[model samples]
Structure formats: structure tokens, C-alpha cells
Target: MYAILGEDKSDVATLKVILKRLIGDDSIKIKTKGYNGCAELLRKGAKQITAFSKLGLAIFVVCYDSDGKDPAKRYSDVVSKIIKPTGLKNTICVVIPVQELEAWILADIQSVTNVFSSWKPKEINNPESIDNPKEYLEKLSRDCNRRPRYNHATHNEKIAPYLDLDKLKCKCPSFLPLVTLAENHDAHVAK
Candidate 1:
């Protein structure tokens, strides 16, 4: 079992779908448990969530956007307040790229083209550094052969299944933790 506590529905949904694919188990329990935002999770809900400690092979993953703030500080916040308080082992915190979580989707350009067909993406060597990723994604998504609504609820879940995690990890530095978590998840499953 893996639990994703994050900002919104679309963002969490994207992570859930990607993790499900990464584990190659459609039946894997990747619990979203409603769309809990980071503020709420850092507050009351963090203590209330017990699955991390109780469930075997569990990983409690938190996803939050950098918001142009210092990721180290944000990471420390989660560590001190959430992870430390719960004393949960195998917790992974990933600071999403500039501005918002949508930038993660753009990390894998090939995947976006695969879903949208002939969707041309500009060369982005460092997707994490891209300013205003949501706006960029929205513009690129509009140009797709088949225009799909670009958002957490609409496009994120749709694109995640087709996402090439390897390619994504290569392009976005922040995505490395996700790869690490997937490896850890696989190791736990094998055990």
C-alpha cells in the first residue's frame, strides 16, 4: 500500500496513476483519501493519518509545489511537522517544479505527444526551472491535435498513464525522488 497526501485532486490523481504504472500493478493500493491540500496535511490531518505506520509495505508520499520558495525550507517543514510527528518510515517528499505540479507532466514531452498526437513541445532541458509551468502546459496542450482540457482533474490523470517515467526523471531534477520512491516500492513488493 502507498498513500499520497498532496495539494489537490488532479495532482494526487496524477501521482496515483503514475505510481500504479511504476509498480506495474493495476490492483496496487495507492490511496488518495480525498483531495487534501498541503496546508491541511501539515496541520490536523497529518496526525490523523495512520496508514503509513499500520500498513505493511507502505510509503507516505507528500507532493508540494516549490511556489518559487526554497524547497529545502519546505522539505524541512514537512519533515519536522509531518514525517517527524508521525514517525513514519519510508516517507518521500518531492518538491514539484516551478509554480505548480503541472510542470511535472511537461517533464516527459514524448508522453504528452503520445497522448495528444503531434503535440510539439519546445526543448526544455530543465523543466523544473521553467517559470509558470501551468501556463506553459495550458498553451502547449491547446496546440495538441486533439485539444484536451489541461488541468489536474482533466488532463493530469489522462496523461499520467502514458507518461514515460524514465524520460521524465531525466528531464526534471526534482522528479528524482519519485524514481527513488518507485525503486523502494518495488523492493518492498519483492520482499
Candidate 2:
């Protein structure tokens, strides 16, 4: 079994979906340690690591965007504070900075404004300008091809773009390796 540790519920959900799609099994247990923060999770994850090590289960830690901090730095911190002291070599850590998880959930207008203060919506000089912001964002997302620039738009921006999640999955540094590992495991079992 693999363990996924992250700051948001959406990351857990997204990872679970991806794992299920790749491995053809939804039985992989995915637990969310905390919401929007990792300090406490890191502490509890330490205990979980020891237990998993005893069971000899392969353990992997996944974290995302420590804001502007380097992923290696964050991984080192988690290892030192949680994994290293536990003396577990079966465990490995993967971190994604400027995490896609955040973008997935906060793919809306108000959320975008909260992150990028300079954002503004393009003024639609029509009666439809009164449409629900969420609906507007959704339509805009579909029309703009889901680019990060759309979702991360400021309040002043009228349209939020869409990102090609499929394309992104392929490009994510951590994604291919995980998929390959799962595929190799399946292949070995078949042999």
C-alpha cells in the first residue's frame, strides 16, 4: 500500500482517482492528514511511518506547493522532522511545488481574487453580466481551454481560463513515475 500526505482534501481525491485509473484498483487507502496545512500531519505521519515500516508496506509521502519554498527543502524538512528519525528506508517523499491541487479546487473567481489581488474581470456590457460568478467561471473555463492563467485571474478579470488537466497529468514530474511504478508492479505480479 502507498500513503499520500497532503494539505488539502482535493489532493487526496485527485491522487486517489489517478491511482485507481492507473492501477485498476480503488482499494488503495488514501488518508488526508490535515486541511491546508502540514505541520500537524507531519507529526502524525511520523507515527504512521513507523507502523507502516513494521508492516513492510511501501510508504510514499506526497506534498504540494509549500508556497514558494523549494520542494527538496520541504521534503528534507519532512524527512528530518518525521521520517529520518523514525529510521525508515522503505519510505520515500514526493513534493509538487506550486501544487496543481490548489488550482483544482480554487478554480473559481472569488478564490482567484483571494490569491491574486490584482485580478479583475473583463466587463461584459450585457444583461448577462449578472450571472452567478461560479457559472460564469465554469463557462469561461470551457471556452478558454482551462489554462492556469484563467483560473488564477484577478478579480478585475472578466474571464477565467481552463487548463488541460489531461496534458498536465502527463507533464507532472511525479505523475509518470508513479504510473510506471504501478504498471511495473502489475507486470511483476503477472509474471
Ten residues in sequence with the least summed lDDT for candidate 2:
152-161
Local distance difference test, candidate 2: 0.50
**What local distance difference test score does each model get?**
0.69, 0.50
TM-scores, all models, native as reference: 0.82, 0.54
Candidate 1, 27: how far from true, in Å? 2.3
Candidate 1 on 58-144: residue-level lDDT in tens? 666777767778878888887777677776555555545556776677677556666666575665667777787877777666655
lDDT at 102 for candidate 1? 68
Residues 1-191, candidate 2: write the lDDT tens digits.
66666666545555555555566666765444434567665666677667765665565656654554565677677767777767766636455543344333233233344434454444232211233433455566557554444432232222222322343343344345455655665653443
lDDT for 27 in candidate 2 is: 76
Q: Which one wins on lDDT?
A: 1
